[model samples]
Target: MLKFEKVSLTFKTEGREQHVLKDLSYTFETGRITAITGVSGIGKTTILNLAAGLLETSEGSVINTFAKTAYVFQEPRLLPWKTALENVTCVCGDEKKAKFYLDILLPEGSDKYPDELSGGMQQRVSIARAMAYDAELVLLDEALKGLDMQTKDAVVKTLREHLKGRTAIMITHDKSELEFCDTVLEISDAPISELKHVNR
Candidate 1:
């Protein structure tokens, strides 16, 4: 489980201060898929960065009990020189599972490099890499932004199979993606509100 206790984050840009979150507290339940929804610039990515320990909070603490975590960002962030299969195997060293996920996400182009594939295909490769990492917690921020409806549904299905008994935290604007999540958290000027709750 991940818990944020009175977390406050502030950014200083151009010698000015921007307050993002002021003493916000929340807990992400375990063994569930949680989706964070909000408009652009509502500090969604900031929350993911803080959860991943990539960013520092001005005050308060973030408690993360999970052992391993894999984060998939908005961009593919793949090595331009690496092929799709190499990208997946680079993290987990499981070539068999890497090939399996790539076959499901990008059946025709596992051997292609990042530049050789389309934007959506590259995003799919990133998703496959995260899934192949086999981490206890998976963090995805706009990870499926470029895919078409059919491709998004297929990739969501693939992710669903791997997410069993594990935790997934995603930040997505696509409403269809929420179908796979056990809980949806909406962020805005107001406090976070639960959109749709599902019992597991």
Candidate 2:
């Protein structure tokens, strides 16, 4: 389970304070997939960072009980020198299991380096790495931004199957991506005072 209690995050830029989240409170229930949607630069990714403990809040607290967590950033962030298979295997250290996910997400270019693959393919490889880790909680930031329709369909299906009974939080700009989530939270307003639940 993940809980945010009156969480607030502020950053100082050019000697000026910028508030991203102000007195925001929300709970991301476990064993569910939650999708967060909002305009760019509205601090959607910041929320994911806070959940992953990658950033500290200026006030309040974030409690995450899950033992293992995996994060797939907007960028593939794969090792440029490593092949697709190696990037996934490096995290879980299980070639067989890594290949399992690679086959589903990157059937064609598992042996290709990051430079050798296209942007969409590289993003798929990142997703495969996270899935291969078998994490209890997964945080995805625009994980499907650049995929073609067919590839997106395949990857979405794979994610739905693999994320069963696990906690997942995804940030996406595309509304079509919300189909795989159980709950959709839309963040608006400067400083992010609250999240409005969008029924689907």
Candidate 3:
């Protein structure tokens, strides 16, 4: 039951304003994945940020029922100073579950610093971190950008296994990613003309 009601967002820097998202409204069913696909620089990440409440909307509401959320950004935002285990342990999300998924996503010898692991391993650590957070909503913004096909498939499979029956919103240009989701939403400059009517 997540929703956006006439939401619009803008950013101002040095007296210059950038319109990131135009007025838009939509809803997502609970316990399902919703994929948002569009060209680059078209407010895709912004939508995920709004849902996670990382940014304030300039107009209208970004409605979410959950107070806790998990965010897996484009880059693996692992803390440089923390070890792989410590990074996931930071959230205190079911110590056993954390270790379990961490073992599933990351392979042997990955229990090292971000600098010590490969790019794909670091992303797996980030995914493990997100899963450890135990949030109701997981917002992923191209979190699998640089991984090779095999690694990406493995990581995606791991995530899906853990995200079963949870709500997830992902932004990806790859049509293949749509297979992981229940609904495919295409956002663009074109307007949604039809308005559905519901009775009280």
The most accurate candidate by TM-score is: 2
The candidate, 1 or 3, that scores higher on TM-score is: 1
CA shift of 37, model 2, Å: 1.0
TM-score of 1: 0.92
Candidate 3: tens digits of C-alpha lDDT, residues 1-200:
68888887878989998777667778877899878776687678888888888889989898999767898999898888988887888775466766876888886744698999888888888888898888888888987777789888988898887678888988888777778887777766533211222221
Query: For residues 23-105, what per-residue lDDT tens digits would candidate 2 score against the true structure?
Result: 99999979999999998999999999999999999999999999989999999999999999999999999999999999999
- In TM-score terms, candidate 2 sits at 0.97
Model 2 alpha-carbon drift over 4 Å, by segment: none
Candidate 3 versus the native: TM-score?
Answer: 0.89
Per-candidate TM-scores read 0.92, 0.97, 0.89
What would you estimate as the lDDT of candidate 2?
A: 0.94
Error of 1 at 138 (Å): 0.9
Model 1: lDDT of residue 86: 95
Runs with alpha carbons beyond 4 Å of true place in candidate 3: 190-200
